[model samples]
Target chain A: MSGGPAGDSAIVVSDLRKSYRGRPAVAGIDLVIPRGEVFSLLGPNGAGKTTTVEILEGHRRRDSGDVRVLGVDPALGRAAWKARIGIVLQRSDDLTQAGALTVRDWARAMAACFPNSRDPDEVIELVGLADRRNARAAHLSGGQRRRLDVALGIIGRPELLFLDEPTTGFDPEARRRFWDLIADLARSGTTILLTTHYLEEAEHLADRVAVIVDGRIMEVGPPQTLGGRATAAATVRWLSPDGPRSVQTCTPAALVTDLAARFGQDVPGLAVERPSLEEVYLRMIGAPA
Target chain B: MNAAATLVRAPALLAVTRARARVEFLVFIREWISVVFTFIFPVLLLIILGSIFHGQRLPGDVDLAQYFVAGMIGAGLFGVSFQNVAIAIPIERDIGTLKRLAGTPMPRSAYFLGKMLMVAFVALAQNVLLLGIGSAFFGLDLPDTVGRWITYLWVIVLGIASCTMLGIAASGFVRNGRTAPAIMSPIAIVLQFISGVYFVFATLPNWMQTVAAIFPLKWIAQGMRSVFLPDGYQAQEPAGSWELDRVALVLAAWCVLAFLVAVRTFRWRARTDD
Candidate 1:
């Protein structure tokens, strides 16, 4: 694939807004996703993640704001512009309608929609669906059907790909496998924009993550440092003569040193735990749990 | 560079249209229920109705079975073109198939054209089945002369085009796949009756004739009657003459208008779209 200019952003948005029945779904928002990065938009249900992605995919119209995908305004995107992007919606079992269509047949049909597309058989294998190549799409398991969705998304060889809640119904092993597939694609320079409710997915797959809630972005950073998670205070615990003692402190390394000195060698039941990405996310969204 | 990005190219519109049509046709034929209803059910209905009033004579001495043959052909065309499309398109939308296509590079025109082509194919198959049943069992007369056959050609073509477009246009009002049959079947049955598919148009009340005249189904049925019935049979028509030119003109007008309405109203999203 011929990479475009390195400095070009795969997607850019400024002051983006959308409303439904007078209620704002995507209030004013701004985002800039550089080319060839795995960027995840993390949010709870009804957080406008889908609205933002839809506008980017040209499936929706923005009320107001400048939005560009692949250097062209998505609102004015033509066939050529659409050819450069791929979208995997939250729920699509399109081949189910063509009940007798096999996985290979579905891939081939979808491939014909694009100017350039991967070989249907190769895509089938890439999605780990080779063994079920002749199995009708309606007969595939949920995870297998999802793989087919991904296969269709990438068949056209899109420079930018949008994945909306891709792993929603996947088992843990299937989710992990899907993550690997996405990571492989990203490594090959495909710019990915992903939305999901799974924070661990964001932590594992995203090069950078944005926390969106109530149609607004709360934080944008690498998952480890999101909401100052990396530098956040850690909890230190150790067994004491009385029973146990614990303290939350920013300087956990210093506290460990002092505890070891006081205990003379080893600190019984010693454990230092830093805030996890999930904790930071839950705190940001203000969910009681 | 990613393999996908490297392979990006604009597929030819014709290729996409052809592939989509093939897939659609395959899927449609695989559904035994659709095949039976679109092609066989109408013929069965004609057989039952034809046998019931087999030897009854109309004003011009035309057999009731023969008159009903023409009427059933018109009804079959309407069912394959209008009723089928109205229900099928909404089902696709309800199931997210249309939404999926919308996100692709395939142009909307190509998608609809593919659908129209599939409907046309089904309509042709239906016409053949009905004609075969009418000729073999009911002794229904067909257009014998070249000119009459030419008239049959245009009438069937225009009838399919106009009715298919009307069905697609009406699909916009259908809430979803589940509601499509409820909304479409009754209207089709009512039109079939008022348009003289079940009885003689002249024998119907004057107001009912006027209402039926406003639609293309009546004109199509009249056109088919002109092709099959003997010359004297014009005496039984509402105008006391076989106005082939008027039939063509009205159907063509409806074809154009219905195409415009379909283009204007067809939605790519589900009913709940914002």
Candidate 2:
């Protein structure tokens, strides 16, 4: 609970618990995100990811435990504290009703809320929204609308940003572009905490990740090492003369070499496969294959 | 760091309020249907009803057109202040707009104040249009003396505050955007009838009169009538007098009560907190 200066870490939580009508949503969770790291919270639907993020964002009250964002306990975070953080909510169709105001106008208005903000047009360009700066928010396509959400979130030039399930409806190309935008933000030293159901997205962007299932953090690590994904037994397979043969082995290279020596030629359909991050995640969550 | 230093001393709350007000106003103006309904509908109703009953007289020798003009203005004020706020707030909540705003650095008071300012602006415009149409075409007298103008100002201010707060308080009952209009429209129509916006209060049943007297809409209508009607026309009122003191007292009390209720019950998110 005694994390140093709020400036040292973007977020710190300990023994956090929240319930909805006697149903536990986030139970005894603990986490710490250093400054400028991209931390992803990965969970299946109804796994308390949104609840945990909302609690950290100060949008929901916790039943018990300590929580801090930017050194201030979010429960007591006022406007001054709020100004230091940015939040792109799970679903925000705000300003769609204000169709007459262009994207730049919306950004300007949002920027005015913070103590220090990026130039509106610069933030728009950073989100790849400069071309449609004059377009009304209502007219933007779904992916474009999400980009605008990101633009608004970052316009405040916040020290920490929270993105809840961003890129949910994005196409493949749009999703990749969004990843780049987020990477650039991280490069510029803005701490990011993102929640997503997309495992590949978490793998691509997260410097560290926490997998939550049924209101608990089942595993926490870098994407490569999550759930021992890096060192898990590899499955070596080859098409033998009889049929396809496969074995799970600790040393896949030795298994492949023995198979090659026995074949005396290239092993047909030879393959050595380690479990993917998604597979490890699904197994950890106890999902039915 | 320099930017933060500069903004640390700036009136950041006021800036947030101004920005929110600007956004609210922009959204309001873009809703052309709302604009026509809130501002033009009242004047149109007055003109049509006034022309049809130009020379008609009510039970107490009150001219029907003149009285109707006053009533429509009152209704218009209620429409822009109370009905609009109540309906719009729930819609914002349903759309997650309020939830998003709640996460921002904008103070909650600044957000509500911004909405109130927009409502006040539209209410004032509706009043000006109604008064203009009434004076120019229906032979209604404008408040000429400073005292009458003062009364007009206080009545309008207090009316808008009370009605708008009540509207915000009522928004809590609307579960989502789709049901907001359905729930609010029927209630507004019923209040209009009971408050004598469309009919004579004295002619109504005693129970209906009592029901209307409990609400602020009735007092707002009575206050407007006091300002616009001749001194003798006060006899037509249910109280048999302008009762300006009671009007002020009732409206002020409602304003305070509604403000407290709204602040207590307001929800930034569509769903329950738990």
Candidate 3:
């Protein structure tokens, strides 16, 4: 196999930092995203997620950092680099200026700016906006408007895509549909950098998840294994004669077997549970209260 | 992956500019308020003012209706090129449209070129409409000589270019769409009144005329007057002559100044961006 323009990595960052008015927004952080991977950055509102993403997108100037997106330093990104990357912003208010340009009109217009662009109609269908292709941007619902954004983002056939809290206002069904669309994009070999407050969204969509807090990264790993979640102690719970009884043990299977044998019959209401990704993530970010 | 194998050829610059202009024109025409203010208001004002001054005459035997016909054309040019762009761009910024484009591979020149095309088309159409109406009903004179026609062309081109650049520069001062009209409308209306668009130049107060002379609107209206009014009417001008040289100089100077100011002040993102 051959490496890309820079290397096997689609994105590389080291000692990334940014500040506003003498206050640090993104403290030192490091990350490397391999090509064709779906990477998610999970953090609280002020935890520097947007700052980090904007730096990588070249929408912002970082105070200090060595960051490469699609094998080019984003701070020095030009037309070529921009052509290779796509961006979906967080809100639909941005589309207010779209005015009377229909979905297909906007898509075709955006496609004209890119060197390697997908067919506008195909992209519209890919984002599930085919039915509303002729509708003006203002006439679309919030979720549909976002789909148009995604459609525009991918129309350039960008190798790397940045989605900033893309599903914030989406309903459950729309979010699920969006996740499927993202999954399809990932399967087609696009590298994705997603930031979201939804833990399940990260767990569902990301090949690797990084939890950031207080301008710093706390951990980075596959969602199921983050914070040692895969190996962490599991809790067993069942009904006892007096009340509910539970115990946390590393040997959960052994404990469950022992309880069943002592009970001498099917243990009523028996259940074993491992720490979910949300639980581990909250704990890593110190959000427990 | 090989760059050549995977990369598709981008659309040509001309094609992109055309696409952008198409979008801009659609947005401009669809916004009913802008259509009313930019296109309709000037024509209506001209008709009303021409009727009010129907039987009057200036010192050069120039009919008052004819005078206002030129004034309205000048005002219409300013409105379409300057006020339209000035207000539209800030609103785009406020709505994040400019930032969205910045992230794309579209060249900055193409974007501005698209804007210029849109403004030029609107200005041309507006000039024709105002002039046709002026000639048919208001008895305004059309330039009969080639020299006067040449002067007309240069003035319109310079006036549109300078005002468009100034509009782009002025957009930077507006914080958002809500404040755009409040800021842009007053400046435009005040300039019209003080620059002889609504009244004769020599009839205005001395201080107002002086203030108006320093701006481009005065020169634009003066240029239009020189084109549409007879050669002998130059005696009525504040300068006692057409001063075609000064008209070109002032408008050209403003075009250069506006370019500089826009380069320094134009912003791609709203002030609220992080």
Cα error, candidate 3, residue A122 (Å): 1.5
Docking class of 3: medium
List model 3's recovered fraction of native interface contacts, to 2 decimals: 0.60
After superposing the true interface residues, what Cα RMSD does each candidate give?
A: 4.2, 3.6, 3.3
Best by lDDT: 3
Candidate 3 TM-score, C-alpha based? 0.94
Candidate 3 lDDT by residue in tens digits, B180-230 = 888999999999999998789989999999999999999999999999998
Give lDDT: candidate 1, residue A132: 98
Local accuracy of candidate 1 as per-residue lDDT tens digits, B1-274: 2445433444777888888888778778877777786667788899899899788988787888899999999999998888888988888888788888888877667777787788888878888888888888787887789999998999988898888888888998888898888889888899999998999888999999999888889999999999888989998787989888888888888878888887788888875555
The true-versus-predicted C-alpha distance at residue B273 of model 3, in Å, is 2.3
Interface RMSD measured for model 3: 3.3
Interface RMSD of 2: 3.6
lDDT of model number 3: 0.88
Ranking by DockQ: 3, 1, 2
How many backbone overlaps does candidate 3 show? 0
- Is 1 or 2 the stronger prediction by lDDT? 1
Model 3 lDDT per residue over A186-286, tens place: 99999999999899899999999999998899998999899898889998999999899999999999988898899997998899998988888878888
Candidate 2 residue pairs that clash: none
Superposition error at B200 for model 2 (Å): 3.3
